[model samples]
Target: MEHVYIGLGSNLADPAEQLRNAVQALGQLPDSVLVGVSAFYQSDSLLPGQPRYTNAVVALDSDLAPLALLDALQAIEIDQGRERHERWGPRTLDLDILLFGDRLIDEPRLKVPHYHMQARPFVLYPLAELAPVDLQLADGRTLKALLADCPFVGLERLPH
Candidate 1:
């Protein structure tokens, strides 16, 4: 199985429950196993005027290919009442493939190591909790280093 990291975020419909439910749903993916999950973090929205978000990272061991895994994640979002009314808009559930087994992918519908994960504390902080300390980014920085420079500092770890 390939090691995969997924980022989860929700700002609508009981955001905390949405994250917990998403983690459970991820465990049910065919040929996949949920490995680890970080404590949920609350952060201000990336876009002004939007609600704060509940965010976390999940580690998985999966046999599914990257695209298939992406499809599964999108399916979970849709199943949980997600709507694409706006770009980076508030959502009921958002699941992003942050990293897929050290593989880099650039596709029309998906990007691995998620394009903006490195720069966003909402993603990086929770990810740091789950990812290996030595995990390297595309820019050749370690996850620890990336966390040091993450500009978004509003993240507050939520209770278990």
Candidate 2:
């Protein structure tokens, strides 16, 4: 099984519940088993003047191909009322495949490690939690070193 990381977020109605439902949907996918999840986090929106977002990371063991996993994620988002209007726009749900066992791929539709994941504290914080055992840096640098340098001022760990 290939270990994969996914970034989860919701800013629409019932954002917390929406995130919970997404985790459930992801757990039920064929050829995939939910391994663990990071604590939920609250962060300012990437888009200005938008509602704050609830973010989390999910660790999974999956046999699905990267593109196929992307398709599944798209379906999950659409089911939760996600619509793409502008870049970095708001959404009911957002699921991003962050990594696939260190393999790198660049396609018009996809980029391994998700193009901008490294720079986003919302994503990096949760990812660091989900895989605290090893800092698997998408960059050659260590995840531990990266975490130390990140200033996710707007991010806070939610109460359990």
Candidate 3:
């Protein structure tokens, strides 16, 4: 099984509970086992006019391929009432494939390492908690180094 990192966020309908339920759903993916989940964070919405979000990162060991994993994630989002009407819109639940076992993919439907991970602390801080110290980007930069340059502020770790 390959290691995979997934970013989860919710801004509607009890955001924290939405994320908690999503994490539980992730553990039920076919051929996958959830390894860990970072602490929930309350962060400002990245896009204007949206409510605050509860964010987290989850680690998993999965035998599914990247595209398959993407499909599964989308399915989970749909199950959680996610809508795609607007880019960066408020979501009931959002699931993004952040890193797929060091694979770099640029397809019409998916991108590995999440094209914008480095710029968002909501993703990076939680991801750093679950990723290895030696984890490197496709360009060979370490996750820790990329996090150093992230300017996103106002992330607060939620109490357990």
lDDT of 1 by residue, 1-160 (tens): 9999999999999999999999999999999999999999999998999899999999999999999999999999999999999888999999999888878788999887698777899999888788878888654668888877886578888999
RMSD of 1: 1.3
lDDT of 3 by residue, 108-148 (tens): 89988798788889999999899876789765778978887
> In candidate 1, how many Å is residue 116 off?
1.2
What's the count of clashing pairs in each model shown?
0, 0, 0
RMSD of 3: 1.1
What is the Cα-based TM-score of model 3?
Answer: 0.96
Query: Per-prediction TM-score, please?
Result: 0.95, 0.93, 0.96
**Alpha-carbon shift of residue 80 in model 2 (angstroms):** 0.9
Q: Candidate 2 local accuracy as lDDT?
A: 0.86
Instruction: Order the candidate numbers by TM-score, best to worst.
Output: 3, 1, 2
Residue 103, model 3, lDDT: 80
